[model samples]
Target: MSEVNEQMMPPKVVLPKLEKNLYEARAIKSFLLTAMVWGLVILASIPLFSVIYMLIVEGGARLDWEAITALPPAGFETGGGFGNAIVGTLVMVGIASAISIPVGVLAAVYLSILEPQSKLATTSRFLAKVLTGFPSILAGVFVYAILVITTKTYSAWAGGVALAVLMLPTVTLAAEEAMRQVPQRMRDAAFGMGCTRTQVIFKVILPTGMPGILTGVILAVAGAAGESAPLLFTALFSNYYMAELAEPTASLSILIYNFSGMPFENQIELAWAASLALVVMVLFFNILARIVGRSKF
Candidate 1:
């Protein structure tokens, strides 16, 4: 049996002394600041919660199954469900997303994977950055000047095009960021295995970056949804039921804008209810995007 000498054993390493109590207090203060920020976020949410609560209290009595299910009323003074507004919002948003997504993703892919150092990419990136900073009203004005007056009509198509412009920068920047987040090693390994650029991007990068892209799309949708100024000039508003895409269609935001100024309590209540609905819908979509983005396919 080998005799182990206690003194011969390696001296047990001692950890450096922790910083003084004052340093610990400073650390605690830093943690408290973080907690305070979270508390502020919670507090900020209160106004939205309060608005929803108030809408529920006032509009709940008027909200019957029939009222909720029925279409918009034939007359302006008469009450009706916001089904038409709902449909208009969906159609416009769908068209806009369709137009924006492909272009944005393509632009992002080029910037991230193809010609990152090229002057053309640089110019395109600069343009996208400029467009992102462009006012929504300016977008509305641009569309109005180009599509509405030139085409000589207010159309859902014009509205969609305008919204697409607004969404493009958001999607492009977000997708580029998302693609950038993918590890270079993963990309290198795929390339090392003789994978084509297209194959690596479509098969590897996009999948990994999907979560962030989805979040960006969600944000874009929410931004577009609440945009009254842009729609004011592009989508316009109609009180009557109209089936034509070329005709001005009423949106929830537009309707709220038109109705909110009325002296009548009923119309005002309707506006509140509509606003609440929009908020809830946007919140639902944001949550869905987060969940879907996080989920494995």
Candidate 2:
């Protein structure tokens, strides 16, 4: 009976191959990963596509060569453009870029390369971050107090200064980050080659980091171009073309602000057209930045 019971007992089971199940699990994981990636892509695309669609629908019909060349008309009368505003925007943004790029890049070089561990560098870096987050309106107010008040008049020069203040930290931090991204090994190799510090930096490091630094400058300029609050306080608005840097200037943003609220359909249309042009300007700068970032040399 005992022998019969032992014979009826279950035999030791043989192990099945785990490799097949493992491969199946891996396939499932890969599929899930692909699905997640596509899901995120679709999620991100919704808002971007929506903005582009809105811009086209609302502004496409209003865009014309006149919009780019003629002075805006007065009152409710139709048949005008934002030529002065476009030109003023360019002039002010150019001034801001000229001011910020050199000072910002020099500060970045000092902080990132010269004396990174010094107290002054730390303070400068901290101040830059603070300024970067400072309110745009406050920048306007600051410039208004300093320049406009001193000069007793709002001018394109004041507007340019305001934009320069806004752009300084952005350019400095971006440039420093770009410089930091240069491989330490490359720096060491330059040193091993008996290159002087200045030689290595100017020849090797700056070249390697130019793409990112230029990208930052381009983006900063785009942001400066779109700003209305600072220009409102500093540049004011002019019905005519800018005659001098110290005179009030027209900009696309201020035009949009001035026109969008007017109880006139003509002005409203001009606003939309100006808005479209501003959007195109910013988009072009972004594209240019991307191209620069991807460029080699």
Candidate 3:
């Protein structure tokens, strides 16, 4: 009876297994990869935070009401602000955006959607890239020679045009990249649903790509806003509020540059203050871009 019961007992099941050394290697590799990633993250953040900390400590003390609303005081005297400079910066940046956005987005659509491999598209892309890599100072020089010299003045209009030139290639390249990121399968599905090419472009593609395009435009404007060299050649400088695009205009960057190297203590303080303001502006735009790009349709 005992022998019969033993024969009827269930057999043990065998489990599939990897070699022990293989498991150890994988675990070590994962640990190394994670450590490298965190190490790089820490390294990258240190300098950025250091700069922000310095700006806050040095500039926060002098960020007063006058700094926002009064004209800069003359050398060695200290009782004014950057009201006009802020206005001029906004005006020129506005004009640049107005010129670049529509034209750049359209060109991107033509290249990425209509004829990506065509000779014209290729040449257009190549030139856009060339412009992107072209020195910002050269952009100022080019506009100086053409618009500033032709108009016979260093005017806000010329500054805006130079910024637009700087913005155009950046916007176009980024927009093209964004458009290409839209899934081909999605386009095919739209077409399969009886959508015309125009409908597909406007209704389908544009909506999906809008956030990325907006991000590119925001970055372009942010860079242009901090530029002093281009504005120097084009807008020159104004001690008074900007009365017209046809006249000299002041900007925060120019104010910072002029003040930072001054012999007077007040000018140095104001330069630090302007630096802080410029940093805040750039940081705000960057945050806004991220938020806008992440928004749902």
Clashes of 3: 1
Tens digits of per-residue lDDT for model 2, 1-297: 999999999998999876545358788898899999999999999999988787787777888998899999999578899999999999999999999999999899999999999999999999999998898989999999999999999899999999999999999999999999999999999999999999988998889999999999999998999999888899999989999999999999999999999999888888888998999999999899999988976
How do these models rank on lDDT, best leading? 2, 3, 1
lDDT (10s digit) by residue, model 1, range 32-56: 9999999999999999788778878
Relative to the unseen true structure, what is the C-alpha lDDT of residue 244 in candidate 2, on a scale of 0 to 100? 92
Q: Model 2: which ten-residue window has the lowest total lDDT?
A: 16-25
Would you estimate the TM-scores of all the predictions? 0.85, 0.86, 0.87
Residue 245 of candidate 3: its Cα lDDT?
Answer: 87
Show model 3 residue runs off by greater than 4 Å: 1-43
- Please provide, for model 3 over 16-40, each residue's C-alpha lDDT reduced to its tens digit, 9 standing for 90 to 100: 8855563587888988999999999
Q: By TM-score, who's the top model here?
A: 3
**Model 3 residue 14 lDDT score:** 94
lDDT of 1: 0.81
Q: What TM value does model 2 have?
A: 0.86
Give me candidate 1's TM-score against the actual structure. Answer: 0.85
Q: Which stretches of candidate 1 lie over 4 Å from their true place?
A: 1-4, 9-46, 71-78, 240-242
